[model samples]
Target: MLMNPRVLVIIPAFNEASNIESTVRAVVDAGYDYIVINDGSKDSTLDICRLNGINVLDLSQNLGIGGAVQAGHKYARHYGYDIDVQVDGDGQHDPKFIPLLVDEIVNGADLAIGSRFLSSTDGFKSTYLRRVGIKWLSFWLQLFTGRSIKDPTSGFRASGCRAIKLFCENYPDDYPEPESIATSLKAGLTVSEVPVRMRERQGGVSSIGGFSSVYYMIKVSLAISIACLTKRS
Candidate 1:
């Protein structure tokens, strides 16, 4: 493993004013350099970040999670960071496990995902329906990529230089968490997962909730399928 790789934490948020502050604070407390991409939050998320003196990139319009995260990757790349770690703004992902993800990257994993399912106990596993949806997606992803990832929908992940450059250039925009995994594997990147405990959202509503959960499953499944078929240049 390379010694002392420069790492940046990327927090993408949209309408997460209630939880963004605490989330950023946790990352800061963890002693990692971070940037918050305020994805045109209609809420006061940007204001909260500015008020707290957090490093932020304000988007003029909301571009969903995919766009926000891609913006972060671009920033990391421009700043010449060796690794980039993504932590959700809703506080579902814990910053303490960030080192584990980064360690996997340093050990040669192109993409290291923080998987709750990898742990047998103590984590917010989401709703049963959501878990079912995640499982279905996982099955398909494994079939296509020939890799088994327990939490393909996880947003808590770390990317090495290869994955960072791939995402910076071409990232999915709609319901991207699961689909991005397919993209990473298709590009011949090494994907691995580590066990991590996550808490329920501290505040604000999840972007995928209620009936949209169904849409999320279908949309992400389709995106993953398409990603498998697309030839990488």
Candidate 2:
């Protein structure tokens, strides 16, 4: 059992004004400390957080998802948090699974991912095209790392102290989810996946849409491949 663990939920938001409040509320109700990283949102995301008295880290410029999440990890490291869970501000990631991810960390996983494909949860799987991209990434990740990761692109994840520190020092700039998994594996960290239910985003469009999906797939694939070639620390 994890006794008195200092768990912190790091939410990375980018113009998610319509969804941030309810997402923060769910996290608050789940009884964990949280901080929202406002990644230079053009919308009222930062204002909403401030109005709700939510702890927030407002960046001066947009840093994409990777930079936003990295900032959160840096904060976790500075504050001495034992575990850091990445929950999206778009409400697609359910806060209820935060404990399960934390439990995996307590059980000795360096990183724990909330996977939608690990179970028969309805309405959790993303769109067909997105799933295709996810599957492609998953296959490459498993082939390179010798580990089965059903949902390599999942943003819902928890990291232990070691991972938090590593991520603070080095994290991808774009399409980070899959590349981060490869990095963890190359570093010899134990990664686990927990079955979790997800919901459609309450608001805001995905950053990767239409033609962006093709770009996203190619970019992530190259990132993962390059990460696999780098020497492990």
Candidate 3:
């Protein structure tokens, strides 16, 4: 159980059977109300959650990363959990930084992001093209939201009730990237970036690669452009 019971960490996982157990144990060690969103994983993901007796919200079909996370937000609202964090299921997000996030939330930020690119972090790569794309999106977010976001696409982040309510109502479905950052900022929630360590994936392969990378960049760029132009009402 968490020493600070109000803080929750929501891990959105899909087909991460090999990494889930260790991930859960580590986060529990860090002391958090850990909730896992099994996004219709085809493997024994749900079984693993059940066997471990962990809090889980299982979906009937794949809802992508955005849906999994937003579902967790909905859970927070329904259960009245005061604070929530997002960590990757592939074990890339380190649990060592959970304390820092908790402190940030306690200090008054609505969202605390673990940014790998905030400084020189070793053993991780975002590629040049991806970095360019990130900068492009960041510029747009800054323009629209008037806030500097270091890692807009970062999956490792913490959010309080302010962000949870916004995301529960409006989050992207697929290829959720910096656009979510824009949406969060538009909602008038406080957002900040904290330095955190990230490791390479322990298992499985990335879905965005080869020609898909180019397509993803183009699609996301267009989506971000569209998002920036419209002011959220």
Which residue pairs collide, candidate 2?
none
Q: How close is candidate 1 to the true structure, as a TM-score?
A: 0.97
Q: Rank all candidate structures by their lDDT, best first, as comma-separated numbers.
A: 2, 1, 3
Residue 199 accuracy (lDDT) in model 3: 84
List, residue by residue over 9-80, the lDDT tens digit for candidate 3: 889999999888889888999877888999999999899999989888999999998899889889888888
- Residues 1-233 of candidate 1 have per-residue lDDT tens digits of 86999999999999999999899889989999999999999989999989989899999999989999999999999999999999999999988899999999999999999999999877899988889988998998998888888999999999999999999999999888889999988888999999999999999888788889888888888898889997766
RMSD of 2: 1.1
The C-alpha TM-scores of every prediction are 0.97, 0.97, 0.90
Q: Write the per-residue lDDT of candidate 2 for residues 182-201, one digit (tens) a residue.
A: 99999888899999999998
For all candidates, the clash counts are 0, 0, 0
Model 3 spans > 4 angstroms off: 1-5, 121-123
| Lowest summed lDDT window (length 10), candidate 3 | 1-10
